[model samples]
Target: MPSFTVVTTAQRYEAIVETGALARLSEFLPSPAAKVFVVTTEDVWQLHGSTVASALSGRSWHRLLFPGGEARKRLSSVEALAEEMVSLGGDRSSIVVAFGGGIVNDLGGFLAAIFMRGVPVVQVPTTLLAQVDAAVGGKTGANLTSGKNLVGAFHQPLVVLTDPSVLHTLPEREYRAGLFEVIKHGIIASEPLFRLMQLERPSVLARDPAAMQQMIAESVRIKSEVVSADEKEGGLRRILNFGHTVGHAFEAETSYTRFLHGEAVGLGMKAAAHLSRLTGRLDAPTCQDILDVVDAYGPFPTLDGIQTENLFARLVNDKKSILGRVHFVLATRIGATEVAAGLAPELIREAIASTLR
Candidate 1:
């Protein structure tokens, strides 16, 4: 088990990233909880629910299961879970333990934040995507029918426990999907990490748990640093959304059925790089290098079939757009990214073509 910690002004929590963490919950939870609720999916509960339940053998426990998928990260789902908790006699002091990936963490965390006004929640992230990115930020939300993450709250988890061992059960596509965010973190903060992905031979990551743990720790540290500086995304926190502007649009445009979040973001970063080159922010060689890294990871969903015009129309509706201009997060090069606000629609369209071409 690899251990990691997140330090924030509100509080500090430790994440134990290994197998059997669910079995160790008795030692991890805070005292004086009236009841414990595990928010999860049926599949997740089927796989490891008994172990978790066994760990809390002496305590009163309730389980809330939702169908597992990105599409379920909605306000209705949040309301359903909240209603279930209320029906189960949840109180302000009750604890919610989210036991799945980013979708569960986001939905469950948001529900815990609003149910009874507020309640303490624990995050047990089971996927690589959640372990490194979404679960750490305390940026919890549910997608509205109109847009992704449209209804949400900023509620930090009382604690987070990550078990990388759980990732072994993840589908290959989903596992590789997470590498995109890992690569994104490297590009934004640590040059060494960026270079590691660039220089290492293919398949090196498969044999290297220590390397993976180190990368996750560094990425978490970068995130913690950013959150510490700007908890509410007033300034530095926006940097964390590096590829999200275009990426989210791509996800929404496809209705999230075709590309996983990280896969779409990987392509989005590539598209943003093309835009950066057109604006002279990045040279062609630098753009190719980043694209090469993404390609080396393989399995990028094609943008050729997606209608660029419709994609741009979707971009115009992005939450980041303000005053009739879309803001793009662009990189001058790997290891450096910036927000280019108020980009004209024409330029934004051109950038997408150049990067996705």
Candidate 2:
């Protein structure tokens, strides 16, 4: 198993990436855990419930299922799940296993963070997107009607277990959408990674066992380094949101139905690259390269019915914005980025509009 510990000011946790990591779930739980609550979606639980049951064969455990979708990623779900946990004798000693994709990880982590004032959580991210991005960061949240992740917390997990083998059963589109976050990691910290992803597009998209395990570890390493240095997205961590300002807008405007998170992010990366070039921070060649790779990984859902003005305007509600000014994480080169605040709306709008066409 390839694993690393993410050190933070308050606590430290390990992220393990391996083919059969989940079967060893018992080895990671804390001693004297009064109850184990596995928060997952019906779709995921149906697929992997038996494996989990076997791993936790002798433990006191329970399952809490939510219908999976962006539409169900709300505070209400957290509240409902929390109430169920309470009814089932959950207490401070209860530990949460967030055993699904991004939305489940976010909701489950938020559930753990708030239940009994706080509890430990083990993030067992099943999807490629959650494995690399959402599961590691400790940034947990639910969406408000106005925008994505509007209500959230910074409760770090006890550990993260990422099993890439499960992805073989993942729907094709979901798996592909997850790759965009890996690309975002490449854009954030490693040109070498970016080049490898572009060069080995075939194997990567094919989900070759060797290639995927390596990619997951490297991407997790990059995220761990950033999170360890700036756990709260204050300075260096802001680069992690490279394409999300516009990406979240796409999700919000579409009522979270038009595009998957990573699909919206794929489109957002193009817009960010355009803004990078338009603002003179990035040269045309690199900007074109960014856009090209994003497209190579994507035939993202068409921006057909997405209103340009409304989508453009939604950027203001992004969590990254400050005092009503939008801040964009723009790539200065393939591996590096700079966060720009208060860029002109017309320029931002132009960048977003460019993607729609």
Candidate 3:
């Protein structure tokens, strides 16, 4: 098993990544809790619920299903899940097993945090995206109509169990979407990781076990180290939001319907690279290096129908923005980034426009 510990001021937890790791769920949660709620989506449950149920066969557990897809990740879903927990006799000692992709992880984590002033959560992320990014960080929340993750909280989980085997069932589009985060990790912190990604592209897309495992493990390690240093996104951790500032705005402007989260982030990375070049922080060659890696993984969402003004309007509401100024993360090089604040809105618009061209 490949595992790492994420230490934050609030709590410390281990993220376990390996094939068939889901079968060892009981070992991870040794305590006999009052009850356990396994929150997931109907699609995911249909595929792997039996295995999950078998893992917790002898325990007091219940499976709670939510509608799948980004559209259903809303505050109302959180409220409903909380209500379900209460009706099922949940208490402070209960545990929440967030057992799907990012949406379930966010919803379940938020539910555990506020259900009874917080309960322990165990993240069992199914999709590649969830395992690599969303599940590791304590950032949890449902989206509001206004923006993505605009209503989330910083609630760490008791443990995060990532079974790489589950990813074999992931659709190619979703798997590729998850790869964007791994590429982002490489671009933001590790040149070696970036080269590895470039080398392993075929095996990664083929879902080769060793290749997939290494990608997931390395990505998690990078995220764990960053979260440990700045768990709350106050400083160094903000770099992890590399393409998210604009990526998230794209999601919101399109009503979360047009692209998967990773696809949007892919487009955002292109815009960020363009901005980096335009501002002279990164030369054209390095900027193209970043763009080439992003384009390699993308048939990214088109910006044809999306308006720059609408994107700018949504950008203003980004959590990273403050006092009418957006805090943008721009790469100085392939493996480095810096936060640029108070960038004129026109500069961002022009960068986005370049993407359309």
lDDT scores in order: 0.79, 0.90, 0.87
For model 3, how does the per-residue alpha-carbon lDDT over 22-129 read when each residue is reduced to its tens digit?
A: 988988885775688999998899898888899998899988888866668888888888888889988888999999999899988998888888999999999999
Q: Taking the tens digit of each residue's C-alpha lDDT, what string does model 2 give over 1-357?
A: 799789898679999999989889989998745699999888888888788989998899999988878778999999999999999999999999999999999999999999989999999999999999999989999988876688999989999999999888899899988889999999989887899788899999899998899789989999999999998888998898888988989877887788988998999899999999999999999998888899998888877888779987787767668898888899999998999987887888899889888
Model 1, 1-357: lDDT tens digits are 555565666667765655567778767777745788899998878787888889888888899997867678888888888889889998877899999989999988998889899887889887778888888778899877776787888888877777666666777787788888888888788888778778763542472565566666667777767876787888788877777788888888887888899998887887787777777788889888888887777667767677778788888788777776777778877778888876666777886766566
**Model 3 global lDDT (CA atoms, 0 to 1):** 0.87
The alpha-carbon deviation from the true structure for residue 353 of candidate 3, after best TM-score superposition, in angstroms, is: 2.6
**Model 3's TM-score against the true structure:** 0.93
**Residue pairs in collision within model 2:** none
Relative to the true structure, candidate 2 reaches a TM of 0.94
- Per-candidate TM-scores read 0.90, 0.94, 0.93
User: TM-score order of candidates, best first?
Assistant: 2, 3, 1
Which one wins on TM-score?
A: 2
